[model samples]
Target chain A: MIMGNLGFLLYGNLVLIVILYLYLYKIRKIIGFQLGMNISMLVGGFGAIATGVLLIYQFPLKFVIVTMITAVIGMLIGAIFGALFDYQTLLTGYINGLMMGMMAPMVGAAANNSVLFLLFIEVVFLFSLVLVFLSAKNT
Target chain B: MNISQFLFVLFCLNGVIGLLFYVVMYKKRKLFTDRFGMVMAMVGSGILSFNLAMMLFFMFPFNLGTLAIISTMVGGGIGILYGALTRFQSLLAGFSQGSLGAIMGTMFGAVVENPALCGLPAAYFIDVEQHMMLFSLFGTGLVISTFGLLFYSLRV
Candidate 1:
């Protein structure tokens, strides 16, 4: 049952991503990357807030803190991307958010130790930062 | 249900609703009321900030709660300013809807947890109930604002 649910989720996420991509592609001419980034940041930020509240309600304070921090950092990176390449930045944020939002709670559930959780957060944060920076610089 | 299952539902709802709203907004951008967009942005930000603040306060210390509210307000203020300067309805509309969704999600999760809080002491119970009521009221306002921004952009 769990595997089936996961499959369904994976498929749903895939469809959402394709739809988002199509929309972004269609609007490339009408709305530039920067503008899209700005809009996406607002959308992404609120989404992060909702997720944070939900996580905090269910998980331990320490784990939720780490997760929220990671989310905020990711959104910041997305905002920067919006400044550099608006639509792409929003797309990247959207995709990353969908994946991370689905994963963070499970990860938090498994986070029994403080040190491991901190390390996990640090790794995720650094990796996202690097990815966003590289994407921004290269594109 | 467990946290994972709960969050999965929230994630799915967010994705589906966002896609639907974006499609509609994209198709009718030219017809959307520009004047109310800014108002919606401000109201959404305020709702989101208050909801976040209460959540933080309930879960953590005052410091984190203060920081979250301040940052959210600043972010919303900046978005509103940028939207006005650029004459971009998208910025305002996006922020408004995003904040509205965030608050709504938070409210839903709170309601899920509300039954557990019924056995608290009198003072804490009153305090917690007050915050919940405030958050719900704000959520309602945001809902009205979002719908207003969506279909009632034009005056009769």
Candidate 2:
């Protein structure tokens, strides 16, 4: 039962990320470097955290592989988002993503038994996404 | 000689290299603007702290709480040193990034040392030592390449 919920959460996150990516792509031209940096960092860090936590929960045995995968995911997301703006933004996003990715799995591991914490994290991520969307729209 | 000894030597080498980079950057600090200095502090401190924490953890796997604290302090120190080249804002950025990196590195080291801590089975015991060696070497290479890139940025 729990495994099923985890899988659902994981897929849901992926879908949300894809949708966000599409939205960002549509407005990529309008984003300034400062906003671009924030967007990249936000997406990269939260995406990595969600991915790491969910994957670790689902597959507790494959710790190392999960860490590597999440780090790569974070790096890619940050780079893609940051690429829309300046090189410095890209560098900032990349480093931030890498650092967050490196940290995420351990957080997941430490909070393994707490479904409530996971839910809270997901809610926070969604709220941030909404905030970003609103901010982007205003700009 | 042994794996632990090798790790210790590598740790010392990394410290020396980090200090040498600091000296070189100090010599040329006046050439950097605020923004560039901020980026330099953030990147340099983050990478150095992460590498240092990971290696230190590998060398001494016992007493994780103490190690984590030590690594974090070391990272903060490095960040302050790097950020001192610039202004207050960069100092703040460097310190935060350094502390974050240190915490992450320490967690990574703890997990690598004992998979069981993360609820992974102990079946991978044989691979733990190998992973440590591989990661430490990779970290060293990363430090060297990153410092080189930072130096090259000055010319451009």
Candidate 3:
């Protein structure tokens, strides 16, 4: 009975759906960047609200305060991203994600296995360049 | 704290942290105004982290010095997959499913070793549930935010 109240996270689900939409459509196309960003903020901010409550009940005021601060910071970051580049598209986001994903391993390897790591990175980068070349002709 | 409870709470915290991080990273008049280079960065880094996590976890040998290596590996792999797949719509689809997938795998593994996990606090030298729940949540956030921030920073 006690936990059931928080169990009904229907509203949270609803909000997550909305952000998914904006992230996929509105912000992707930059239709109304501010609106989309606001939606994103709602998703994150609401979670913060819920968790802040949980933290206070479960832990202490200090932990709650820290969580609140972190939540605010995350919201601010989303807003900043929206305000700065409201016209970006999801396709582009995807591509950027791809590049970064491919590189980190090399970075990691370099820290441990410099020679082999650099060689692997070079190969991956070379292949990636080719992919970029091919994708460039997509549209 | 309970593992399940910790996971739920941590994810909730991640949601908040992501929002704030996004705001600070991309806050500007021209924010999202142009695709700039972030789109590319996101794709690259996203795939990198996700894949990194998966690869390290699935492929690497189980050892004390290399467990973190797996997490990071899986994270990169996931990132690369994100980059290659559908965006926004695809991301949510993948994220929710992938997260559940991760949880399921972890559950099964633990179940197989239930006796050990539940019993060997001293033998294993770790609080299985509490540790995993906290780490998984934090790791998810860390990987996602890592990609998100890397792309945003690169572009803007």
Please name the candidate that would achieve the greatest TM-score relative to the true structure: 2
The per-residue C-alpha lDDT of model 1 at residue B144 equals: 42
Instruction: Give the per-residue lDDT of model 2 (tens digit) for A30-89.
Output: 888778888988988888888888888888777777877887788787777777776666
lDDT of 3 by residue, B49-100 (tens): 3323332333323752355544544443443344233345444433443343
How would you class the docking of model 2? acceptable
Task: Report, in order, each candidate's fnat.
Answer: 0.00, 0.37, 0.20
lDDT of each: 0.41, 0.83, 0.38
The prediction achieving the highest lDDT against the true structure is 2
TM-score of 2: 0.84
> Please, what are the lDDT tens digits per residue for candidate 1 over residues A1-139?
3322433433443354345435445444555555555445543443343343334334343332344354554355334434334324533444334324423443434443334454445344445334433443444
Interface RMSD of 1: 11.5
Tell me how far the alpha carbon of residue B150 in candidate 3 is from the true structure, in angstroms, after superposition.
16
Q: Which residue pairs show collisions in model 1? A: A33-A86, A33-A87, A34-A86
Q: Lowest summed-lDDT stretch of 10 residues in model 2 chain B?
A: B115-124
Docking class of 3: incorrect
- The TM-score measured for candidate 1 stands at 0.32
Better of 1 and 2 by lDDT: 2
How much is the lDDT of residue A36 in candidate 1? 55
All candidates in order of lDDT, best leading: 2, 1, 3
Off by more than 4 A, model 2: A5-12, A113-115, B20-24, B124-126, B141-156
